[model samples]
Every structure is written in structure tokens, then in C-alpha cells.
Target: MKKILLPTDFSENSWNAITYALQLFKNEECTFFLLNTFAPAVYQVEYLLVMPQPDETLNVYKESSLRNLEMLKERMQTEFSNPKHSIETISIFNTLVHQINEEIQDKSIDYIIMGTKGATGAREILFGSNTVFVLKKVKCPIIAVPETFTYESPHEILFPTDYGINYQDEHIQPLLNLTGNNVARINILHVDKGRGLTEYQERNKQQLESYFKHSAYLFHSVQNESVQEAIANFQLKVRVNLLVMLNNKHSFFENLFFKSTINQIGFHLNIPFFVIPTKLGKK
Candidate 1:
């Protein structure tokens, strides 16, 4: 069974992401883990650092978290009512990223689906602080749903790559599963530096094409432009529904996100971004 993690803060944005995930995998038998990471307020955390036992106020926070999670689960069951999916709610008294890391191994999570930024997060930051943290540290494939994005059947998926890493079926299994299982088209975008593909890159490209040979696919090559610009223009041109990218180190994915600000670079991801980690830390 596929195991998917849904981290929520009981916000409408997070609930929307959960709704999207459930609908996306409604036909496939899957287990959904609804996780809520509750951290004490600033002053309370400082106090807890000094005190061995959490005070009554801390217990109140824990109680509220558990209650909200249970309510959320009930809401999911009432609204979606999909027998193929199982909802498991977990409420932890820990930080967001830290708790997410712990659950990744404990639950053997397949995919992490969440909103880019939640209600409490500032809208000014392109990618929320929590999302950037998870994208950098977590090793699992993550699907970040933009706050403004609504549930739409993804007919066109844009997978931008440099063809630097050798293509592997296992690497893109998540993506291929969606496109092949459903009536979706995979659009592969490669930004070239005026120089054509190298011998190895050409082989990798062929291998990738071979993987989706039976499915509807299109490969596009744009010359002499930054990867971000190419993605922006192509997304606008095609009106892509989903954006997929492999987060390989020292690549465009890292350069685009591993920064203080994303808006400073003149591009903001408006669609759901499916990021697959090139390398995952061993459990």
C-alpha cells in the first residue's frame, strides 16, 4: 500500500492539500497519515527547556492538538468517504521539520504532500520557511501545493531537468505512476546552454523517453536561458497543471530554492511542485 504523509496546522490551505491528495489517489489503495506538529510558544518552550515536566499550559496545548486532529480525521471521512484510503492522525509535541523527519522513517512514508505555506506563514516569502526547510532536509519525494492552487485534474505535467543525472525508472516512479495510470501527458523540458547535449546526456534522454514510450509525452528544448526563466515561459505557454523536478545536488533545483528569497530571482511557483529527492538518506 502507498503511504502518504499529510502535515497540517488545521488551516484551510492544508485541508485543501489533503483534499487534493485524496482525490489524486482515490482509486489506488493508500494509507494517509495526518500529522500535526505542535510546538509550545516561544516563552513556553524556554520554560520547558528549564523544566523537566511540562506545565498545565503545555498539557492544554497537547489536548487541543489531539482534539483538532481527531476532528480533522472525521471531516476527511465525512467528506471524501473513500474506502481505498485510510486516515491515521498523529499529534506530536515537537517542531514541524523535526517531527516530520521522525515520522518519515516511523511510518515508512512514500510521499509528503502539503501546502507551500500555511495560514500563519507570511505571504511575502515565496516559499514558506517550513517548506524550504523540509525541501532541503527531508529525503522523501514531496508534493507542495501552492496556497492559491485548487484541485484540478493534471492533464499536463512539466518535468524540468538538466539531464545531468543518469535516468532511472525508480527515480521517477512517482511521476510515471501518475501519468501512466491516468490520462496525463508528461512534458520534459531541458534548458540548454547553446551547447548541445553531451554523449552521456543524449543516452540519458533516450532512456527517459523510453520510460514513457507508451504514455503521451513531449520533449522540449529551449536554448540560451536560465532554467527558472525557461520554466516560467514554458509554464505560461503550456498552462501546465503540475510541475515536477528532481532535486539533485549542485543543480538548478538547489540553486532555485536554496536561497534567502525566491521572489528576488523573478519567479514564483504558482502550481503544485512535485520534488523527488535524487538521494534519500538510508533508514
Candidate 2:
């Protein structure tokens, strides 16, 4: 069974992401973990040194968190009743990233699906504060669902890579599982900056080519525009259903969204983004 970890703040945005994940893996048997983390509004040093959890504020937060998790589970059961999907709820007084990492081990989670932000937040921000922190701290594969994105079959996937990091089997496993399950075609786009691939990059490219040998994919190289512009134009031209990238430091993924000619987030990023954490490579 597939174990999918869903961290929710009980907001519509988080609910949006949960709904998308359910529909995305509707056919496959999955156990979804609905988790909500809470911390006291204020922590007193005396309380921390003495009692781990206080009586008043901590109790209030715990009750609220538990209530919200139960409600979310009920909502999921009522709205999306699928024999293949079973959901479990968790309410913990911990930080988001720490809770997620713990659950990844406790439940053997496969994917962490979450919204980019709460409510209709500014699209200028690529990810919410929690999400960006989680991306940096968590090594598990995660899917960031935009606030207003409607669920769609990920038939066409757009993968933007600079081929900077060495390829690893663990890094590619999630992509392989997803594409293999959906029988989707991958469109690999390489943004040309008037320079050729370095020897290391070429090696990584060859490895990627080998990995996709039995799959249907097209490699496109485009130039004369910024990487962000290139991505938006490609999405416009192809109507891609998903956009994927690795959070590899010092790579294109690190700076992909910083500068754009439009100066705003596009539906290009609105498409469900599959982010593979870079540090997930072999220990």
C-alpha cells in the first residue's frame, strides 16, 4: 500500500492539496496520513524546564488540533469515498518539518503532498514559508499543490533540469513510479545559456537518457530567453499537466523562480509541482 503524508493547517489550501492527492492516486491503493502540528502561542522557560506540556495553552492547542484532524478525516471520507484509499489522522504538538520527518519513518511514507500556502496567497511567492522550510529540511519527495489548482490527470509532465547533480536511483524512483503508473510522457526541457553542457553535466544527461530509454519522452533545448520565460512558453505551447524539479542547491532549481519577465507567478507553476529534495541522494 502507498503511504502518503498530508500535513494540513485545516485551511482550504491544505484541503485543496489533500483532494488533489486523493484523485491523483484514485486507482492505486493508498493509506493517507492527515497530520496537523501545533505549538503553544507562547512558551515560558520555567514551563519548558519543568513540565513539558503546560495545562492551559498547550491543552487548548492540542484539543483544537485534534478536532481539526478528525474533521479533515471525516471530510475526506465523505467527499472521496474510495475502497482503495484509507486515511489516518494525527495531531501532534511539534514543528511541521520535524513532524513530517518523524512520520516518514513511523509510517514509511512515500510522498508528502501539501499546498503552497494558506488561502489565495500572493502568487509571487513560489512557496509558503512552511513549505520552503520543509523543502530544505525534508528529504522525502513532495508535491506542492497550488492554492487554486484544480485536480487534473498528470498525463504530460514538464521536467526542467540543468543536470548539475549526479543522478541517483533513489532520486529517480518517485518519477519512475509516477510515470509508470500513469503511463505518462515526459517532456525534458534544457534551457540553453549560450553554453554547452559540462563534461559532468553531459554524463548526468547520458544517465538520464538511459533512465528514460524505455519511456516516452522528448528533450528540447531552447535559448534567447530567461529560464523562467522558457518554462512559461513551453508550458503554454504544450499544455503540460505537471512540472517537476529537484531542490538541488547551486542548480537551476535554486534560482528558477527568482527572476521572471512577468514578475508574477504563472499557472505554469500552478500545475502540481513535483519537488525531489537534493540531499536525498545516497548518504
Could you say which candidate leads in TM-score? 1
Q: Give the alpha carbon lDDT tens digit for every residue of 173-256 in model 1.
A: 878777755689999999989889999999989889888888889999999778888888897789798999999987778888
Q: Which ten residues in a row have the lowest lDDT in candidate 1?
A: 117-126
Task: Give candidate 2's total backbone clashes.
Answer: 0
TM-scores for the candidates: 0.91, 0.88
lDDT of 2: 0.82
Per-residue lDDT tens digits for candidate 2, residues 44-94, read 444444655546647878888888888889989999999999999898766
Candidate 1 Cα deviation (angstroms), residue 17:
0.7
Candidate 1 ranges beyond 4 A from true positions? 43-56, 118-124, 261-263
Clashes per model (N, Cα, C within 3 A): 0, 0
The per-model lDDT (C-alpha) reads 0.84, 0.82
